[model samples]
Every structure is written in structure tokens, then in C-alpha cells.
Target chain A: MSGNPVERLGRGTTDLVVDLGGLARFAGRVVVAGSGRPWRLRRLLDEVFGIGVLSISIIGLSGLVVGLVLGLQGYNTLVRFGAENSLGAVVGLTLIRELGPVLTALLVAGRAGSAIAAEIGSMVVTEQLDGLRMMSVDPEDFVVAPKAMAMVISMPLLSALFITLGLFGGMVVAVGIVGGDAGIYLTSLESSVEFREDVLGSLVKALVFGVLVALIATWRGYTAEPNAAGVSAATTSTVVASSVSVLIFDFFITALWRV
Target chain B: MNVSPLRDLLVGCFVLAGLLSLAYLSVTLGGLSYRGPGGLQIHATFDEVGGLKPRAPVVIGGVKVGQIKSIQLDGDLRPRAVLDVDPAVGIPVDSSASILTSGVLGDQYIGIELGAEEDVLKGGDEIQYTQSAVILERLIGKVVQNLGADSE
Candidate 1:
């Protein structure tokens, strides 16, 4: 606290590097523990129920709303150039390739990501994790692995649902509301999107985001200080860090996909 | 976290919905269909394909019957396109396959002009009359040249 500016900057850099290394190690541990015998199907299912099933309403509603807005906006813009027929392609491609996975990840990071961090952080503060350790139950296997594994399993499914609902919403606006030909809308949408590129790429992106968000949330909670303030800080950090990493990783994934 | 039958049921439903949505996205919207060996496969060689791409629709009278299976080069080094046409559409052997743009700036597709021949095209048959894509710049240049000739 009393160090000069240069010393403080140096110390901060060291802490950042150390924290990154720690996070990576924690992620490896979770993967190893998750992949081990017995599979812990029950614990994983409970977490999936908490994380994936519970977040569906928010994800589905947001997807539909986003699609509606895209349809409205795309129609207005494309109509100027007499390209309103391509509105379906525009909305579909945008949602499938970019918005669907990214938005779902961000929403999940906010909803389930924060929940995971808070729950695990509070457990840390309350010495529940320690109690599990005392009982010779590796906390990583009993708790962390299931949560992390559930996030991975849930992400792509939730993303697919988001894209589907978004497409329906777009159709409702483009065909039902905007007076566009339903056949033309659907044809354009189907023709424009490719299976290998758009759909697979989207699932891959969602999967990557799932891994990142899960690792960040769990790692933050596991490494939090054993106090109430630490739990709060861990929860906040999980949200902020998960969101920023999702966006950054999204850019890289997109660039790599093109390659 | 304790596992309950109710919770398992809800999770099952969620997983099912998610998978159904994924299927819809992949099969319906993404156009991942079964490429059975059922269609009438025909070949057409073009001088220049322009912006024509694989999987572009093969249409007759503005109705899509099938699509372009693949675009490759022939022995003559020209762009040869394999078209997967519907078997029921008894297109004459003398029909021509022309690469046409959908709109002013839309995707390029193959348009078939049916001939008055009695014999229908079969699998692996070559389309004798094939028209290459209309390059916009070439069209503009021709117009500009025609105007110059008129002035002279």
C-alpha cells in the first residue's frame, strides 16, 4: 500500500500473470476431475437443471425480441434498395452466425454464471467446501466438476434454441407483420445459411464460450478469499470477466473460422 | 444438489427442446438435406461461371427443382457444373442451361430453357447448349463500344 507507482505496477503485473496461471491450472483440474470415472451423472443433471433449464425463458424471450427488432430494422433498410426479400437471409444469418451464440453466452454469463460464482463463493465463505474436504470428498469432483461440465453440455443447446426462436420471431415480423411473402422469406433464409459453415461454426462458438465462462466462474469462486466481501468480489468478478472474455474469444473464433 | 424425478423430467424436456431446435437450424434452415443418388445428374460446361457457386438453385420457370451439385473444370479447362435435377421433370436433351443472376445484385443460379425434343435427358448426359454468366462489366463495355461505333 505504501509502494511507489512503479513498484505497484510491477506487483500488479505479477499478480495478473499468477492469477492467469492459477486459472489455467484450475481449469485443467476441473477437466481431469470431470472426465474421471463414475461420471457423477446425478450431480451434473442437477446443475444442468439449475443452469440450462432454468435459463431457457430468458434466453428464448430475448432471442425472439432480438429477432423481431432485426426484422423490423432489416425491412426498413432493405426496402429502400428494394431488397426487402433478402430480409430473411439477413436476419437468419445474423442470428445464426453471430447474435445467437454470443447473446446467449452473455445472458448465461449474467444469469447462470453469476449464480454459480455466488453459490460456490458463499460455500467457500461458509466452509462447506472445507467440510466436503474433511469428509475426504474432493470438492472439485463433488461440486466444481459437475457445475463446469453442466455449463459445457448446456451452452450449445441453449444457443440452438435461441437461434431457432430468433428465426421464428424474424419470420413473424417479416411475413406476418411486414407483408412479405412467406415462401420467399423462408426460401431466402434456407438458401443463404449453409450447414458446414454457419450452423457448425455457431455450435463451436457456443461450446468455446461455455468452456470459458464455466472455467472463469468456477475458478474465481474457488480462489476467492474466505470472507463475505471476498464472496461478493468473486461473484462480481465472475460476471465482468466472463462477459469480457466471451466477446474477445468470439472475435478470435470468428477470425479462425474464416481461416 | 439432490436429484428428483420431477427435476429429471424437466431436464429431459429442456434437452429435447434444445436438440429439436438444433435439428431445425441444421436441417431446415441450414439446408443440410440427404443427398441421395436419386436425382437426374447432368453436366453443363460454361465458358465463365461468373459468381455462380455450388448449391445454387437449379430452377425452371422460376421454380427450384434441384440445385447445382458441384462446379469443377472440364478437360477443356472451362468451368463444368454438375446439376442435380429432379427425375420427374422430363427435360429434353436439347435444353440449355444458362447461368443467370437472380436479381440486379442477387445470387447467381442456373436457369433451364426446355427444348422441344422428344428424348429426355438422362443421368451423366452432357448439356450441349450451355450459356455462361453475363458479366456486368463486359455488358457495359459492349454498350460503350457500340456507342463509339455509331459515332464513327
Candidate 2:
């Protein structure tokens, strides 16, 4: 039984190595397909409308709710120490530095990443990609590039909107509901958050998460087996894989930010 | 397939809102500004700046007229702070600058009280009188020592 477990572990490691190789090759093809002439602006707009515009309400509402919760909890904790005045700085820094980008990416991964994978998976199952190839058209250029590019364009904007709403929500809870001094809250927030360091870092994190999610989703769909079950599996894996990688990369980015 | 104009317009609005929120975050909360070097520069030396830092506000009579541009150590190893004030706000040459905290544990800032001299302070001038930051620990220690001496 012990040897059996070791054998399974060895097989799993080999499979992971092989999958990583395939993913790298697929990513190279996508970059080549996306960067060339005929910028494909129309399809990109359609994808952006699908991915970004539709995701705004969820992103905004989640941001506000999270901010409110942070304010409430932060105030309760800080009041004990008589540091309730620093609530704004705490909420603002936490949102801009970490939660805003990470939450937005996770939301996008669940909402849009699954859809991209399923749509591409269905297209593959229906042999539409084969049809496009038969017509001397590249499916990667026509289908994958626009979706990936739209994700890259939308992520930072959505993250910014999320953070803005979060700050407003936090202010509502901290000042309006709790009766903290508005001037102190605002000044504390402004003083603590630096544009060059925290704001720019948040946007960069969002952008990197965008690239990671887009590549993983597209690659999964393109390589999925041509069947209904395969399409569902691809969608599920897209959500799971992208979410994991977004969090992992967030850790790495934050650790290396000052370096 | 051609997209509808209304849809494109919605997308445009979304993009605009995103950019607007980004601008708000960067400018208001992040304290970004495009002001050039149009302010009057003056210097003050202090024994201890305490929590005073660069970009701390410089106010007179509770009205802000400037900010600390930088903080450096002078040849005497004292903290020399450079203040950037609005050129429009004239200051007297004999004015005094003091480092004061906002509350018991809030951030520290520089407050200047105007002197009675007719001559307005000019650029690169130095404030004649200055007070250093009050350390809380030292104050408490002094109070304890005074009580001890009185009991003895």
C-alpha cells in the first residue's frame, strides 16, 4: 500500500511536468497570435463588453460589502485600544494593497474564466475550430486572442472601481454610522497611502493576475477533449486553476515588490 | 458581428467611470499633485523633530500655508527642516516655528506663529526661534521625578 501511494505520486509529478510544458508552448502560440497585425478591435470590444461590463455590478457590490465589514470589525478591534481614529488608514491600505486586486481577480476567474473555457470548449466540440482551420483561418487569432486581450484590459479598471467603492463604503461605516470625525478619517487615509507605492502596486498586481487568468483559461479550453463532459471539466478546472494561480502570484508579487 | 451603438456607449461609460475612480484614488487619497515649485522656501532647525516627517503640513494660526518639503541634518547634527509655503502668504522674519502633535497620539506637524517685524520673510530665510517636539516619555519621567523630589 505504501509503494502504491509512492507510485501514484510519481505519476502525478510526471503529469504535472508534462502539463506545464504544454501550457508554456500554448502560451507562446497565444502571444504570437495576439501581437501581429489586424489588431482585431471589434472582437476585443465584444469580449470586453462580455467580461468587463457585465462583471462591474458584482465587483462593485462585493467591494462595498467587504469594506463595510472591514470598517465594522476594524472599529470594534481598534476601539478597545483607543485607536479607532486610524480606521480609515487601516481600511484604505488593506483595500488598495491587497484585497482589491485579489478579490477582483477571483471574481473574474469565477465569472468570466469559466465562461471563456466553456465557450471555447463547446466550439471545439462542435468542430467550429476545425471549420475555421479548413477555411485557412487561425482559431487562436480569431477566438482566443480577443478574449485574452479583453481580460488584460479589463482587470485593472475593475480593480480600481472595486477599490473606489470599497473606500466609499468604509467611509460610510466609519464616519456616517460610527460618528468618527470625517476630517480625521480622510486625512489619515490620504497620509498613509502613497500614490507611487500602494496605488501603482495595486494596479500592477491586477494586471499580472489578468494575464495569468487569461492564459490559463484559454489554454485549458483549447486543449480540452471534444465532449460535453470535457467542456464542463475544462470550465471547472479553469476556475480552480486560475483562482489558485492568482493567489500564488499575488504572494510572490507582494514579496518582491520592494526588491 | 457588429455591436450595437448603445452597447458600445455603455462600454465607454464603464471605461470612463473606471478612469475617474482611478484618478480619485491617485489624487485625493494618494495625495498626488502637479504643483510646481511656486512656493516660498524657508528653513528651521530643531533639536528633535519627533514624529515630524517630510510632507507634514505647516500651518499658521491653524490655517495651512505650507508643507515640509524635506528634513535633513545640519552641520551641527540638528534636524533642519525645509518648509515650502505659498508665495502669496507673507511671513515675518522673526517668526517662530514649533513642532506640535495634533492630539495625544496623532501625527506631528509644524506650526509657525508670526512675529511683529515689518519685514516679511523672504525665500531661503531662516526662522529665528524654534521649539522641538515634546517627547511623551520624557514628560512623564519628569513628572515622576518631581513628585519623588517633593516627597523627599
| Highest-scoring model, TM-score | 1
Per-residue alpha-carbon lDDT of candidate 1 for residues A136-158, written as tens digits (9 for 90 to 100): 98899999999999999999999
lDDT of 1 by residue, B1-152 (tens): 55579999999999999999998988887666634678889999999999998889899999988888899998889999999988989999999999999768889999999999999999999999999999999999999999999999
Overlapping backbone residue pairs in candidate 2 total: 0
Please, what are the lDDT tens digits per residue for candidate 2 over residues B1-152?
77699889888988998899889888887666523578789999999999998878899999878788889999999999999988898898888999999988888999999999999988899998999999999999999999999999
* Model 2 alpha-carbon miss at residue B73, Å: 4.3
CA shift of A216, model 2, Å = 1.2
Point out where model 2 deviates above 4 Å: A1-11, B34-44, B69-76, B82-96, B114-129
Model 1 residue A22 distance off true place after TM-score fit, in angstroms: 1.3
Q: Report the C-alpha lDDT of model 2 over A1-259, residue by residue, as the tens digit.
A: 2568889899889999999999998888888998997789889888999999999999999999999998999899999999999999999999999999999999999999999999999999999999999999899999999999999999999999999999888899988889988787888898788777898899899999999999999988998899999999999999999999999999998898841
The best candidate by DockQ is 1
Count of residue pairs whose backbone atoms collide, per candidate: 0, 0
Candidate 1 matches the true fold with a TM-score of 0.89
Show where candidate 1 strays beyond 4 Å. Answer: B34-42, B60-65, B72-77, B84-96, B101-106, B112-128, B136-152
